[model samples]
Target chain A: MNIAVLGAGNIAWHLSKALIHAGHPVKQIWNRTSEKAVALALEIGADSISTLNQIDTDIDLIIIAVSDEAIESVAKDLQLLPHQLLVHTSGSTALDVLLTYTQKAGVIYPLQTFSKAVQVDFSQIPIGIEAFDEGSTQALFNLAKTLSTKTYYINSQQRLVLHAAAVFACNFTNHFYSIAQELIQQSGLDFNLIRPLIQETAAKVQQVLPQEAQTGPAKRNDQLTIQKHLDLLKTNPAWKLLYEQISQDIVKMYSKDTSSLK
Target chain B: MNIAVLGAGNIAWHLSKALIHAGHPVKQIWNRTSEKAVALALEIGADSISTLNQIDTDIDLIIIAVSDEAIESVAKDLQLLPHQLLVHTSGSTALDVLLTYTQKAGVIYPLQTFSKAVQVDFSQIPIGIEAFDEGSTQALFNLAKTLSTKTYYINSQQRLVLHAAAVFACNFTNHFYSIAQELIQQSGLDFNLIRPLIQETAAKVQQVLPQEAQTGPAKRNDQLTIQKHLDLLKTNPAWKLLYEQISQDIVKMYSKDTSSLK
Candidate 1:
């Protein structure tokens, strides 16, 4: 299948490479910055376009792999035939945003973090697909299958929740590591000491439920150790509050007392 | 060197197994429950003692791998010769706690979560050692070197900070996964969809700093997406509050202006 990628960012770079490697021909690549677009196009053997209007109407699929805010504007600027499918690769953006510009619209959101430096294994990364109609859905699903082994037909509402959950699981978790790094650095200790613990925690969740895998002073309701940690964080009021709040939440979860409503 | 394990808990099981595997002789295994002690002792070809008085004075090293609250009592109960070294496998406990029980006291705290069900490779596990004197410190260091490749001479204050950091990086991070799992389960979406995302997020930290690796609506400061997620979380006040707090913290971190304090 012939496809046109509409971005020059990390996601676009990785997605275009994966699609090309999967035997799909990328016909055109467009970005607001022509340098990045030209570089990506040359790498993927695709035509470099400076504007959305330069995209050919003959392409079978047009994947708008731009930022969430740019999806609608990019869709409005595109000049495509009604038969050509247009989809935005965003987890938060609603499908209706694409329908405003084209009748044949869909979403093929890859539910994983992408980095230009990192080579992602698309085979395990989940691709969530949603389309305006049954035929377009099948086409997007078929295309997604070529790039990933795990594909799901997710609606807009479910995708929103998935994105939120990803924020907590991925984004928030990374922030926790940052906090850990700060704590160790302040104590004049190497942050690399905690690397194995971080990896092991993630690995444990793969086989066991996170609830069951939970351990530490909070889970054990050891107030003494908790108080010690809180006192240690006295210099940083923000961190102290965060530690107190999360510890309270964990204590509540394990206490089996739902008197205090969540 | 002759070693006696003072508990049959998860840490004791793993530590004893690793010590034995490293060619160090486990002279005895003792626990309040004789059955568990016997099971672990038989597995590692060591004597199982039901009472603390049964501990042989001939042992070179005594490792008290009990709960934080029981460490002092276990140390008080141990009957060791003057030259024999004593240690507790605790991160938060100070080196002085062990010195109260024996002149030759040290610590061999492993900075990783352990489980009886999961087998761990000690090569990557960081062993934090602290002792009352230089000679005991060297002796404990030699013992730790046998079980782990990563050994550090961390003082009591540093170990306290390290333990606190582990809570943020491992324990609190796992709680975030629990929150994500809860959210996805409520939405009737497979939690497995986010598993790859979780793994990738952890993997990113191995190469890049967590501060630089952070991504999501929070990091992007996309208030619209944040508000939408907040609206979806209205029914669950506990989660809603958590979501708001963490998102606010992330936004504060990325926003150059320090006017907004969380």
Candidate 2:
């Protein structure tokens, strides 16, 4: 498909490069700041567009890769035709956000974090495709399949749920790591000591359920060790709250009387 | 050094095997339950003893890798000479526990989790060593260096802190995985979609600090998306409490007002 990309952000840089490498024509790139677009277009052999009106009308697809709050505005400003399929690469935004601009609306949300300098293995990242119509959906699946081995048909609600789940799995999990780093640092220990343990904790869940992969004082309900940890965190109110809440929940989950959980 | 193991649990199973593989002579194993001791001893080519008196007095080191509460009793039961070294593989227990029984006390606690079915690379696991005296500490350093590339002279207080840190890094982090798994499954989505994201989250921390690697609504303080996620967890009181506490902490840590955090 002949594609034009809007915004030169992290997602745009990685996704556009992946698409072009997968033998698609990513012919034009546009951004509010044209220098970013120009720089990226230069690297990928595509033309840079300062104005949305400069996007090729003959392009089969135009992707708005801007932030969620900017999606509707970018969609409104884009110059489109009746035939061009329009999509946004946002997990939270609905395809209907683009309906005001065109009837040919779709979503191709990659369920992974992207940073400009990081080299992403696109084949390992899962793509969640949703569209207002069947043709547009099929177009996204085809576009997505070129770069990834996994693609699923997910609606807007499920996409939102997945986004929330990602926040817990990726964002919240990293925060726990940050807490661990803080605790270790306060004790004058190198953060490097816990790195292998962090890696193995994640690796363990890949082979088994997270509940079954669980190990620790809370999992075993060792109140003695729990109290020792609590005493250590007595001065840090924030960490104390988190440790207590998380440990209590873990104990409740693993305890025989799990009647409240389900 | 000729070593005798006093327990046949997770730590004993992995550490003794690593010691044997490193060509250290692990001569005898004894546990309260003789069957467990026999099973582990057979696997590691060591003698299993039902009575502590049956242990080889010629052994240079004795490792008490039992439960933290049991460490005191086990130390009392072991028969050791003035020249022999005795250590407990517990992060929370102190060298003082052994001081009651022997003057040659030390600790060699591995800062990693072990399961019966999995094969752990001892070279990657960090060992935290503490001893009552210089001679015992030197013996532990030499013994630990044979199996692991990383070893630290961590005193009892520091070892306690490290143990709490590991709970956050490994056990609490896995519980976060469990929470993510629950959220995804509750939405009728497959948990597999987030595995790659979880792996990358951990992998990013290995290269950079966790604070620098943090990404998500809380990190950026995106209130709109945060509200949406909170709405989703409104029915789950346990999850709701955790979400609110953790997100609030992340926001406070990242927000411009540097009032609360150190």
The best candidate by lDDT is 1
User: Model 1: per-residue lDDT, tens digit, A109-219?
Assistant: 899988787777999999999999999999999989999999999999999999988988999899999999988988899988999999999988888878888889998
Clashes of 2: 0
Where does model 1 exceed 4 Å of error?
A257-262, B257-262
CA lDDT, candidate 2, residue B254: 86
TM-scores for candidates 1 onward, in order = 0.96, 0.95
Interface RMSD of each: 1.0, 1.0
What stretches of model 2 exceed 4 Å from their correct place? A257-262, B257-262
lDDT of 2 at A123: 93
Per-candidate clashes come to 2, 0
**DockQ-based class of model 2:** medium
C-alpha lDDT score of every prediction, in listed order: 0.89, 0.88
